[model samples]
Every structure is written in structure tokens, then in C-alpha cells.
Target chain A: AQTVTQSQPEMSVQEAETVTLSCTYDTSESDYYLFWYKQPPSRQMILVIRQEAYKQQNATENRFSVNFQKAAKSFSLKISDSQLGDAAMYFCAYRSQSAGGTSYGKLTFGQGTILTVHP
Target chain B: DAGVTQSPTHLIKTRGQHVTLRCSPISGHKSVSWYQQVLGQGPQFIFQYYEKEERGRGNFPDRFSARQFPNYSSELNVNALLLGDSALYLCASSLAGPTGELFFGEGSRLTVL
Candidate 1:
């Protein structure tokens, strides 16, 4: 069994600034996937970014990037030039990539961090 | 191409009643997964179906059942519902690969009274 944790229950950032949300996971498997998802008040869960365990290069998507520390089992999301629309509940998720296993394809998610971007 | 789509955006049911939620994967996707999201919490995995076969299941009870059709559409049925069952039901779709990235749908919110 795997578990993800987000120690920060709430976070706030000023518009046009940068903020980072923290996440950690406990998994014995080496090959897997890590993801960040954002859910706004509209209730739509949108994929923010993803990091493959084998890849050391951090993932970047415009203003959203990830600092994935595989050895330390930490994956954090960094939002640069934040905007009001960035306010939402962000979740860290994990998925196993093993070819054949009972837990394959299921995502274990962390308790979300509600982010508030103040103008 | 439409993203994963789910039906019955919101509904209310009494305890012990039965409820069924539906999902349609992205046009070319062959894998569909279901998750439950309690308020103020992250979504929890419930089940996953690929090519109309059950590929994975979470720690949820037997009251939660789901299936995928030949066209890759899926349904989640919950029987003898309890108040604890009240939550947002989310459906996600992915490609054939075991580690394909998942695309989520706007969930179906169920309120069990």
C-alpha cells in the first residue's frame, strides 16, 4: 500500500508572486508516477503536471513546474507569477507503473491544499 | 475531442437507496477509472476498467460496483447506500498504456440523506 501526504492544509500567495506547495509519499516501488491536480470552486479536477519516476529533469508547464526529489520522496509544485485564477484545491497523486500488478493504474492521493491567491 | 464526460451532475437519494453514475471516456481512450471525493478532501480511487475488464479496485466495499462497455463508456453503481456514500464521484480516462496520464471529468455529486 502507498500513501501521499500534504502537510500544508492551506496556502496563500499574492498575485504576481511565486508559491510552492509541498507533498511527500511513502512507496517502496521505484518506478511510478507523480501528479499534481487542481480543483477550483467549479469542481473540475484539472491535471496540473506530472513527473515520471525515472526522469530526473523537472517537469515544467508555463507557470507551473515541479521540483521532484525522487531519493527523498518529495514532489512539490511551484507556481510562478501566480494569478487569481490559480486559487484552488491542489492535490498530489501517485500511480504505479508496474507492468502487471493489482494496484496498477490506481491513484493514491494526498490530502489537498487549498491555495488562495490574493490580488 | 471531448474530455471524459459523466452524467447526472448532481443527485440526492435516501439511505438504503440505490444509485448509478455513468461515464464516457475520451474518444480513443480504452481505460476508465472511478474515484470518490469527500468534501474538503482529495479524491479516493474506487475502481479501474480497461478494455471492458476490471483491472484494479481500491479499498471500497462491495456496495460499490462498476463496469465498462465495449465503446469504453462506464457506470458506477452503489447499492444500499449509506450517508457516508454521499460524495463527488469522479470518472477519469486514459490511453492503453499501464502508466498513461489520466484525464478527469467534472464529477457527479451524490448526496445521500
Candidate 2:
């Protein structure tokens, strides 16, 4: 069983500043995927960024990026130039890669960290 | 392209009653997954369906059941719902299974009285 942990229950960042949300996971599988998801007040879950365990390089998307340290079992999300729209609950997730080439989309998610972007 | 869409954005049900939630996956998407999100918590996986077949199930009880239609639309059914079942139910769709990035719906908020 894989477990994702987000130690921070809530975080706040000033507008136009940068923020980093920490995440750690426990998984024995060598091939897996890590992800950060954002859920706004609208209650819609949106993918922020994703990183593959096998890849040493981190993943970046727009202002969102991940610092994936496979050896440390850490995958942290960094949001640059944070805007008010970035205020949301962020969740870290893990998924094991299935051999059938089907992403076994069953995700183990952390408790989540509520992020508030202050103006 | 349209993302995942769920119906009955909000519903109120009494304990012991049954509830059903619907989900329509994005066009060309064949897989649909369901999750339950309690207040102040991350969503928990309930079930995943692909090609109208059950692909994977989470640790949820048998009270939680779901199915995907030929058109790839899906429905989640919960029987004898408990107060614990009162939460936001989310439906997500992807190209395949969990390995891929999921596109999630706005979610159906179920409040059990």
C-alpha cells in the first residue's frame, strides 16, 4: 500500500510570490507516478503537475513544478508567481504503473493542504 | 474538449436512503473513476471502470457500486447510505486507468441527514 503525506494542513502565500508545498510518499514499486492536484471552492479537482518515479528530472507546468527526489521519496510542488486563483486545497497523489500499459488510475492521496494566496 | 461532468451537483439524502450519482467522461475517453471526498480531506478512490467493465476498486464497502455505460458515461450507486457517506462525490475520466493524468468533474455534493 502506498501512502502520500502532506505535513502542512494549511499554507498562505503573498500574491506574486512563490510557495512550495511539501509531499512525501511510501511505495516499494520502482515504477510509479506522483501528482499534485488542486481543488478550488468550485469543488473541481484539477491536475497541477506530475512526475514519474523513473525519471530523475522534475516536472514543470506553467507556474507549477515539482521537486521529485525519488531516493528520499519526496515530491514537492512549487508555485511561482502565485495569484489569488491559486488559492485552493492541494493534494498529493501516487499511482503504481501497471504492466498492461494501463495507468491503474487508482490513486492514494494525502490529506491535503489548503493554500491561500494573499493579495 | 469537454472535461468530465457530473450531475445533481447537490443533493440531500436521509440516512439509510440510497443515492445515485452520474458522470459523463470526456469525448474519446473510455475510462471513468469515482472518488469520495469528505470535508477537509482529499478524495478517496471508490471505483474505476473502463470499456463498460470493472477495472479496479478501492477499499470501499460493497455498499458502493458503479458501472460504466457503452457510451462511457458512468454512475455511482451507494446503498443504505450512512452519515459517513455524506461527502462530495467526484467523477474523473482519463485516457486509460490511474496511471494517466485524470480530468475530474466538479463533483456531486451529497449531504446525508
For model 1, the stretches where C-alpha displacement exceeds 4 angstroms are A102-104
* Model 2 lDDT tens row, B1-113: 78888999999999899999999999998989899999998889899898998888888999999988989999999999899999999998888644567889999999999
| TM-scores for all predictions | 0.97, 0.96
Interface RMSD against the true structure, candidate 1: 1.6
* Candidate 1 to truth, TM: 0.97
Q: What lDDT tens digits, residue by residue, belong to model 1 across residues B2-110?
A: 8888999999999999999999999999989999999999999999998899999988999999999989899999999999999999999988775677888999999
Count of clashes, each model: 0, 5
TM-score of chain A of each: 0.97, 0.95
Off by over 4 Å in 2: A100-103, B97-99
